[model samples]
Target: MTEKQVIYLDFKASKILLDGDFNAKLSDCGLAKLGPTNGNSHVTTSIIGTYGYVAPEYVATGDLYVKSDVYSFGVCCLNY
Candidate 1:
């Protein structure tokens, strides 16, 4: 996925689903936001997501970015 795509604001281990064929799928997109590709971020007033999986910058400033979801994906990978 590129930065121009949507960002899964609630990305976490619990939000992922693996099928019998090991196909990964993301769920619970109620907090997702559209990411910016011009080196900018999507800012919001509400900060909601699972602890330990949310990005530090997002937690500090409610700024959403594609990297935030990438951070959560990395954490999920570490669990396996």
Candidate 2:
């Protein structure tokens, strides 16, 4: 119905159901889709994420998986 609702549905379908990792947290602003903010027409297409926060496999290849996030988690532990 609303833009936010549509975006949420898309995120659910893409990141949750497809990815099968509902609890997989991202460093971004909790948005699966990268786009412009409120009243801003500049929609960004690139999926730019943090440097060390991203997984190796995901960084090497565009393919993302739960394991990739796990790798990132391990890296985070090492950093701490």
**Per-model tally of clashing residue pairs:** 0, 0
lDDT of 1: 0.78
Best by lDDT: 1
Clashing pairs for predicted structure model 1, backbone only: none
For model 2, state the Cα shift of residue 37 in Å: 28
The candidate that wins on TM-score is 1
lDDT of 2 by residue, 1-80 (tens): 53541121012112322236556533324544433446654332334456666655555655444344456455556764
Q: For model 1, give the RMSD to the true fold.
A: 3.1
Model 1 lDDT at residue 58:
87
lDDT of 1 by residue, 1-80 (tens): 55357878777777789999999888778877777756565645478888888888889998776678888888888998
Q: Among all windows of ten consecutive residues in candidate 1, which has the lowest summed lDDT?
A: 36-45
